[model samples]
Target: MDDRIIASLETAVGATPDDAVLRVHLAELLLAAGRREEAVRHAATALAADPTSGPARAVLADALDEGAPAPQAPAEDAAGTGEGFDWSRAEQEVGDLAPPMYADGAQDPQGRAFDVEHGDVRLSDVGGLEKVKERLEASFLAPLRNPELRRLYGKSLRGGLLLYGPPGCGKTFLAKAVAGELGAAFLHVALADVLDMYVGSSERNVAELFRVARESGPCVLFLDELDALGQKRSLTRNSGMRTTVNQLLTELDGIGRDNEGVYVLAATNHPWDVDPALRRPGRLDRTLLVLPPDRPAREAILRTHLRGRPIEGIDLPALAKRTDGLSGADLAHLCESAAEVALMDSVRSGTPRMIGMPDFAAALEEVRPSIEPWLETARNVALFANNDGQYDELARYLRKRGRR
Candidate 1:
């Protein structure tokens, strides 16, 4: 089958000598067939015709990754008659064959749909974080669903949200839920995406990201562990980090006023580590701290996670009481740990059935809250949080706890 695909690709390339699109397609097919060396040659040919062909460049990069040799022009045949190909005509034909460029002047071959990935934790899948959900609904969902309300109020909804909390407390999960709720194109911008070792590349990538978001309107750009990109300049020796942050700040500022449809959502465990400028009024204005689940929330989380399992003898309320100071994620982990115990029991006792209370009780020894480190950061955030400031909600939560 691979040989057939490669043969067809070769035939297509030969027939469409000047067609860059065909060449690129052939390159993709070759790459898929593990013919990296051949793919590189085709990609190089396509790029030679259309210098701005991103797909060809991407294919070339993949080929290079597989140690493919550089492409060279073929020598004359035994006929000894040098049939000089019209390079300019080939270039024009390839250029014409290429797909329409994005409004941001970038070639996105996979299109907007390419941004969506397979694995995603939906809002319904999340066990707890009721307050977090309500806040997101009010801030994000409400604004998106009722655009007219925002227009009447003369407020342009912009400047993405920042979710800061302990690890395993559902910050990332909440970000995913927001994307799912909005039904918008979700782009997870990794720290590496915006951070480059090259001098201006980091800044350029940041600008390109916002540009992509604008072109793909009603999109959500979720920057996870945003502190890596938005860290305080003083804390880093890498000049690239500083440049990236500056670029992000500029993009975010413009996005607030210009991007009527694009939404930016970022998550970080160490909010204090983030640059102060980013947390100010214009960048990530609305910050939400996802705390560990309370007793009621924990019980609800357990029940949600254990919905399909046969737990006839289990008492969720009692388990919730035992699991105090645990986050929603922690509860989920607990359920998983219990399931592991049940599996072990099934293997030992030959009864592959329900997970009893003993399984849960034993799992408790292994599952623990991941919120301790964030507690210190939350304390610092609380100190900076003024009554009238944007972090008032976070401040209130910390103050109520009183321990720090």
Candidate 2:
């Protein structure tokens, strides 16, 4: 089946050499077939011909994962005779496009310095979601900004916020941005680091984490994947797991008004799985639903991802319009796809060109937004488990979107 599609697309591209869209189509087909080299070649050709093509750029971005680009194809063009093409030159051109994807994130926090003064990320850097930003202002930021008023009204310096959403919708990014916004240090905690195989050790780890947060006042301690740390006790018959939840609850409330300058934030894809005790007032009580990136946010995310890469004629507004349901991570993936396509095309045609729109279109068609299943699950929970109106916001969103 793939052979037939490739044959047809190749013929179409051959008949109309200037039809960059056809080349993008061929690039998508080749990419799907795991022919990364061929895909990048077509994508590069498409971009070279029409540098403004979004699909071309999107494909170019995705093919190359940082530091691990696919090997270039043979010197000869597989589609036609290699004329006016320099294979080595084209390969080199692609090498300069995609920087290492993991260079910014995924660093081990244990080995890294996270001093508050070292953080450069600010809320302004976070694009779109004005509503989320507003919520943060009212519930989280207002007191910090207006401390005199907060003191007059009897508000505390510390608070707990639980960010809940589908996977890859920028929860962790938002957490860091919040820390940056507040000029606070960011402490990212993972369950694997806290969970111990020995009896009673996991509880101790939780205590130590809280202790570290208390000592590092004015810090944002972000607990990634909260569901793992505080899952419902009824569901887990394991005594160790229940103990961890109890310890977490104790830490959240603190023993002697101790959580004083530390702000606790937790993110979870499965909020319903979190123990009910954790959601009670004064714990991770405030839940903000981080939906898929809205249109404006999607545009910002795309722009951020493609900023340093070799890109041309990208209509970010138009691209964002086309990618209505994609998450922040999905937009990042689209950019990567664009780069990958350009790289492959550079090798095939022996001409490295800037990424274009055709590559983006091709990649967009292949990479689906990973939000549907999450929404489906959320819808069920909103309808059935939201007995106390806790998920009223989610229910309203589902109904507005006609998913309820």
Candidate 3:
């Protein structure tokens, strides 16, 4: 039977590549022969050739279920056997078999939907960054909820907010928390999403990004690793990267003060690397430095992360003091590493149980800070200080440390 199926596939491949029916038949044969992965490839090719091909789609779905834990009804159960179920032909015969049309009209599929998308994280879940949270709430959440306050201000809220600091400092997490606090839609737009090889496609993606945010009012557009998209063209030799930055700038500038209900929250490790135009007043006006957790903040972070874990008495204050330069994310990772050490110890002793202080200390030694290089670069950028009060606190911290 396997040989017969292989012969059929060879014949099908020899035939025109556009033969959707033959492709589906070959895929089905391959699936029955236990070549599930190859079956999926053939089925996908068939679907690409004729998107409306129901038999091909059914075969592809069946192929996906192979070796998967979940139980799925066989194609025979769904469409019946020995009938050569051609969905395209069936749709043509019975007009009602067409694809469902959405009432919302044509729009960018990736865009935020105000009534649909919501944040996954809450302020309570954040565990630390109390001061930062309070500041953000005052600036964004307060004005958003109280329409009276906004009216009193008279001017519509404008520009984006940038969260810049060391990696693992909870910039992205804070953005999510803000979204949840405001009860607004959260659309995280990464640099990869807007990148394209084709001309105009990159710009189109940027337009779509802002367009979706506008359509979905009361939305938070979170751009992560923003330096990738907003990088200064002077540093890059690639015209494509420069074009992408220009497109981003144009989209940002287009969203003026009048565009209320849509908020842009961007995060970057290297704020200085971003184009000056993007950092201008109407673009990213509010630049919040999300620094590494201070002594008190670090203690809170350690306690929060270690809670409910089977740990042999941890002196959190001592730990916090030791982890002076660590970010919230770094602390979390350190805790994870400690847990792994405990797991290894348990396995060695043939007993699985709680982690001890020694385990944590050992893990701390193994897992050093990941942001040292980035921090050094940031220090260099800070040398030619524009005297923006934004850097005062960070500058003070750096001056004492003496540049990494």
Candidate 4:
């Protein structure tokens, strides 16, 4: 069957080297077959064939990201901001850990998102959320940013932080900004990309990814949707997921060596579902609740989307004030809705016109905050699952918002 699949892909590639989709499929197949080098080659070819292709980029990123032991660059990059780390021996370590099922069953880990790139948007780039910023500054950033003070206090940088909140509220965005603030390479690992594979293979993948992260020092490994991987052991029936969680615990504890420069950050919408083991100190112990965007944040998002677009009489302050409870995405949709209204109106009148407050007003009615349901659900979790007061921050936010 492997031979057949390879033969078919080879024939297809021969028939059409210009077909980017076929090349991407061939790349994914090669990757699933454990031919990392070939997979990367095909993915690069596909990307060159179609520079605008998203799948080609994805395949290429996944190949570069997971293959590990990529060739090292000069100590300093063109930006001269940070030096690259050597990932020279990653492939050797992973080869031993990789299970036989991959070659036998053909379970592909690509096609899922795994991105590692540099970030430039700093914490200041984030709109508002003063309290959130303050908490992060005190807990996550202070140690790295203030090395002298950190040494005076004997603070260690090896630890994990878990950010929990409703979806579309910028948990991932904040993670990237945190990386940007540190000027570190950001590796975004969607947990679903790692967890649902064969037995022992999932654990190997988790271990290998962390190995890559450790080698790539000053790297911010942002694991989004962590609950799926760390779901409560009692509630979960899968032994494979449980092993993955244990592997995560081991990696966090820095079992063999120091985790000095590799900062681990994870975000999940359902913190309650995450395994309690993962929350123990020296792991993902510290928790921060990322709530809906405040008025200032909404305004920032609106302005960002509206910039360079023709508009008039758009009272940003008024709209921001009225848009209480809207998430960043919700605010973006509101802006899009208003722009769509103006575009349609211009078409009907056969005269171009700028978007106005009325269109924004109509958008307000159409796009109510999608966070209310999340808030309601959060209220229950905060109130009932206030076990040991972990959800105290959430409870306080709910009470302050008068939604409790």
C-alpha TM-scores of all predictions? 0.65, 0.70, 0.69, 0.71
Give residue 183's lDDT in candidate 3 (0 to 100). Answer: 78
**Model 2 spans > 4 angstroms off:** 1-118, 156-159
Worst 10 residues of 1 by lDDT: 110-119
Model 1 has a clash total of: 1
lDDT of 1 at 154: 68
Per-residue C-alpha lDDT of model 3 across residues 179-229, encoded as one tens digit per residue: 888778888888888888898888788877778887777889899888898
Worst 10 residues of 2 by lDDT: 109-118
Q: Between 1 and 2, whose lDDT is larger?
A: 2
- Report the candidate with higher TM-score, 2 versus 3: 2
Q: Please write out the lDDT profile of model 4 over residues 47-68, one tens digit for every residue.
A: 8878998987887888778866
Error of 3 at 374 (Å): 2.3
Model 1 CA deviation exceeding 4 Å by range: 1-114, 117-128, 255-258, 307-311, 351-353, 380-392, 402-404
> Which of the two, 2 or 3, has more lDDT?
2
Over all chains combined, what TM-score does candidate 1 have?
0.65
lDDT of 1 at 362: 94
Arrange candidates, best TM-score first: 4, 2, 3, 1
lDDT digits (tens) for residues 235-295 of candidate 2: 9999999999999998888876578778899999999999989988888888898888888
What are the RMSD figures for all models against the true structure?
15.6, 19.6, 13.6, 18.7
Better of 1 and 3 by TM-score: 3
User: Total backbone clashes of model 2?
Assistant: 42
lDDT per model, in order? 0.79, 0.85, 0.80, 0.84
Query: Which sections of candidate 4 miss by over 4 Å?
Result: 1-114
Model 1 residue 75 lDDT score = 54
